[model samples]
Target: MTTGGIARQVVLRAAATAAGPALLLRRWTTADADALVEAYRDPVLRAWTRLGVPDAGAAVRWVEAQRTGWEGGGRLSFAVVEEEPGGGRVAGNVVLKRPEPAGPAGEVGYWTAAHARGRGVAPRALQVLTDWVFETFAGQGLEYLELMHQVDNTASCRVAEKAGYGFERVLPAVPPFPRDGHLHLRWATGGPVPG
Candidate 1:
């Protein structure tokens, strides 16, 4: 299928405004179940996401949970589709999760589909999402965007670099992984100017 066809099937129209040429950043939808299954079932995706292999039922539940997060507020998950000649296929996913009580800092996370790897999709999606966060929620104190990648995931680090986020530092005690854990990298954007 063409990328446009995949986009029409995978991308939510409401979130289309947040899209760019190389990628589409859209809100999660219940209807995304099928595409979610197709994308998430890839072994590479499972590795990067750390979400484990999902059955069809599990995939449905996962997409539903993402939608729930939107309704609940303070979290925004976007489906990233690569724009090909005839539109684009669902390349992967990205997220801008607002931190509680931290004020204006958003944590960013992303994963690219196996087929779309090495094609510059993730960084492009990140740039669009970052721009959208600044424009849509800057008034609400959106200041910095932070990302953490498994040090072993060199490709992800490259994407962060391409998107203009500097290497911050490696921190220990990171949760969901290990105490002696993943390296943390942070980038500040759209925050109040210092005195």
Candidate 2:
């Protein structure tokens, strides 16, 4: 399979969490299907997310497929959960998926729930995910990391900037939208890679 195609197969297992401000990144499980459905079903989430699944049942099946990919060695998909302020369930979720090839680098895609907006969740989760990706996959010839957000997603742009991703370019009329015109902001981290 192609690198990107292979990446789609890999499922990222959960990472350990320690005390003092932690961002728990883990692989999706059957247990999380409900949470995934609930989060993705939100209208705001539906707007920005690129998920292809049509319903909750499909979401569950998708997670299962990702698990199979995890067992293989293709892609990494993670769920971001933060500890509550006082003590309870995690606030919500932030997700990062590793794209294949990424042309000498890795591409990251992320999203945060409506309830978790403006809480710094995306930035924190992004930092952890990016650091881990670079460290663990350095041997894979990765030189940079890339992220993209719709022109209208100011909040996402802020997170990318805060996380140290520099603006690289803008693609006009890509990923066309029905109403708003197409415009995408591309951001990069680390540095340029040799061809």
Candidate 3:
């Protein structure tokens, strides 16, 4: 999808992790439907995630939505996959969304499947996504990325920190969910990013 004046595809090599399988960040596909269904079966995932892709059919719609978003120049969604001997397993998802393409900023959001939790999947995938965004959109006016999570979600806090996004501020309660939220940010630098 086109964001902040740049357009590029998401491709990734295996990202090394502390434990478990290597991670790969790539565009979402309909083939990921079954995995999406299984991942959503986790109560934690269902409660935390905004999109409710509870079944294969719904997951297909979710993938189609991403494709539509990409074609319409809005959000870019990636499937976070873990590499194993037989093949890659869908571990979770990460998305970069820009409400205003003319703006110089965007928001990042992620979730890790139950099996992928505690294995550094979210942070590793987010780090790669952040790097790709800055590198691919360097001269296209993309300057900053932001992430928000419920203050009580300590795991998400850790993910933000591990991904090198500085905690910006704690936003007050907002709506039905995500009360006591914290805002995190990462600015583009010409050199290597920390995490």
Candidate 4:
């Protein structure tokens, strides 16, 4: 598989004015550490995603880890930033990791920032990421994507549904987490996966 050139230029569609500016899925940078630290401080985010950046230093480490993961293969991480005047805010993150290089599947994970929640950000960001991945990596052998969330996370389930991921089944005894979770699947369409 072509690892180095995985996501050279995968920009998603520009959002309509009524919705918002086009969502940009770019690689995380050190400048985003502060926002990431603040985003992880959200109680709801910590409770659900269990990710906590804690401080700017740790946030920088987290961002660096994501970059290393991309460089090492098997992972692709993007900051979900909304387009606005004078740059944009770090709204959230969407990541595809644990890729099966020789297989046709990968896992996706995401979380919306506290201030960005409830504005259709997560679902729309996920939709764009999913579409970009399937289209850009099709020739590299990617075929399907999988998303799993705590069964009790109704909001995440809704996001998966809105992003066109079909409910597959409940995966039991998932390691690192005790509770059973719902498994959602979205296969790559010839074009963008319809949401």
Candidate 5:
């Protein structure tokens, strides 16, 4: 519930892809458990992230973890929702995680639901999240943002570049991730940040 006033400052911006629904970035809620689990059902998502949400109970825990992270002021995550007539549907998730509160940099992660892929959901949400991070944490000493994805994940590579996280270097293969990965970095103000 203590999300750096993010809950009160939701709706960072409204964006629409010429042919897609408007997008809104907000904090995760327990009510989103079902949707979260449903999105994770996609094999591609499960394969890449290795995060398996087998049921609503697991999804609730995942959401609760985000709340805990917020309260602890560590990882700030947003639920990317696409607006429709009846209501808003979750399109993706974006998160900015800082292991050290006053660290010079933080890491970012994101995923677009199967239904929302190819609709520009990942890049749009990531851009909003990156801007928010710089605006909200620059004064706290956060100077840069980093994004990493396996080299084989072309979709993620595109998302990283589209969001302006320029390639920094290659990361070593680690456990759970047998493949080498690419590290993309963006400075607080002077980097390849998109407009």
Candidate 6:
């Protein structure tokens, strides 16, 4: 799909690591707004992200925000889709945010659709995004990526670990995040996954 404001669509693919199917990661198009709005309908997703995407309009705005981030040269996001003979479908979303144009650190976040859960979509999509950020932003300056999720979000904990993000610390509840969070880190090198 064509990405708004994105000069070149960066598609990241990872082959089936096991029984899970191969997956494709690409920019979220306006067409995916409906899927995103539907995804936010899931209570599980809403509670975690604390997002108020109650309709298509909000989803469109959200998609536009991602595009703005892309055009600004930071905060990359993707619509994780599973490739199939029939075609690819939105499996989830993965974002690598806060990589300042001249900074050394960034953050990673992702969520799997209700239908795509338990198939290793979160971690796989995360791995693909992680790899692309560190490589594609070569001169922009990147040394590490952090992932923070509520301590009770065991699924995210698993995704982080599976994606090779080492448990860094426990973060106190702050504003939007009501519960303590687990901060996971994956360094550019000399850490888990080794750059």
Largest TM-score belongs to which candidate?
A: 5
TM-score of 5: 0.92
Scored by lDDT, model 4 comes in at 0.82
Count of backbone collisions within predicted model 1: 1
User: Which ten contiguous residues of candidate 2 have the minimum total lDDT?
Assistant: 178-187
What tens digits encode model 3's per-residue C-alpha lDDT throughout 100-167?
76678889999999988888888888988898878876776778999999988999999999999999
Q: What's the lDDT for all of these models?
A: 0.66, 0.60, 0.83, 0.82, 0.86, 0.85
TM-score of each: 0.77, 0.72, 0.89, 0.89, 0.92, 0.90
**Model 1 lDDT tens row, 88-174:** 677778887764624857788888877777767787788777666666665666567788877777887889888777777766655
Q: Report the Cα lDDT for residue 122, model 2.
A: 72
Cα distance off (Å), candidate 4, residue 73: 2.4
Worst 10 residues of 5 by lDDT: 1-10
Q: Tell me the TM-score of model 3.
A: 0.89
Q: What shift in Å separates residue 85 of candidate 1 from its native position after superposition?
A: 7.0
The pairs that clash in candidate 6 are none
Of 3 and 6, the candidate ahead on lDDT is 6
- lDDT by residue for model 5 (1-195), tens: 335544544566557878578888888999999999899999999988867888999999999998888877778888999988899899889998987887888999999899999988898889988888888776888889989999899999999999898998999999989899999998987764576
Candidate 3 colliding pairs: none
State model 2's lDDT.
0.60
Candidate 6's TM-score reads 0.90
Ten-residue stretch with the least lDDT total in model 3: 1-10
Candidate 3 clash figure, as a count? 0
lDDT of 6 by residue, 63-180 (tens): 9988887777567889998898898788899997774556888998999888889999998889888888778666666778889999999999999999999999999999977899
lDDT of 4 by residue, 74-160 (tens): 788889888888988888899888556667788898998988887878888888888777776778777788999989889999999
